[model samples]
Target: MIFVNILISFIVIIILQLLGMVILSKMTPFNDMEELNKGNVAVGLVFGGQFLGTAIILGVAAYTNSSIWYMALWFAVGYVCLLLSYWIFDWLTPGIKLSDQLKDGNKAVALLLACVYIGIGFAVSSLII
Candidate 1:
């Protein structure tokens, strides 16, 4: 029963996070998937942003009165959430423009993309916990 609860909770959190990311992507002006697939430095920034965002949010969730099951489940769900966010972004903005910008080493655009991912990730994680 405990394992089942953990799995269900994890799935719920992942779905919620994915939904949040979709909403965020529409609101943001940047997309990171284009750069990531093209093997650019922007990928590093995106990863960094995602890592920090997930760490802080999951860390906080792990704290407080959350059970061990909740913490572990949230952490696992967060990773799936991140990937879903990227997939959703690609689907929503299928144009090649973002890739073009990254190819030219546009730091501003890269930063914007990273910020969006981190912001959304953090926001969704907080809501779940």
Candidate 2:
């Protein structure tokens, strides 16, 4: 029974992560996989940060909740927070458009945005408890 529960949890988490990525891809103007294929480090960094951020929240949600439904609910909350953080970052920088900078291959902008995503993820993960 324990093994089965663990397997189910693993599968659910993977599905949630994929769903998060799909949603993120839709939110962005550029194609993430295509940029990644073109060796765009800026896109890679931001996408990696987004993946890690969502993973952090999913980890917390899985750790704190035994029920899959509750885990899913928390995951949803965490995902929304991550998305909002990106929007907030854009709002904070009124003079520059982050997506445009990223598309232009600005490594510095990518690094800062990645950091912001990870930082907010850590903060939001703490609240999952």
Q: Each model's TM-score, in the order given?
A: 0.54, 0.92
Candidate 2: pairs in clash: none
| Candidate achieving the largest lDDT | 2
- Put down candidate 1 lDDT per residue, 1-129, tens digits, no spaces: 978856765675566445544553453365645545676676556556766666655666655434756755665676567667666665676763554555566676567667766776687677673
Model 1: clashing residue pairs?
Answer: none
Q: After superposition, how far is residue 20 of candidate 1 from its true place, in Å?
A: 19
Residue 56 displacement (Å), model 2: 1.2
Q: Which whole-number lDDT from 0 to 100 does residue 93 have in model 2?
A: 94
Query: Least lDDT summed over 10 consecutive residues: which range in candidate 1?
Result: 19-28
Instruction: Evaluate model 2: give its lDDT.
Output: 0.85
Candidate 1: residue 121 Cα off by (Å): 2.0
Residue 106 displacement (Å), model 2: 1.4
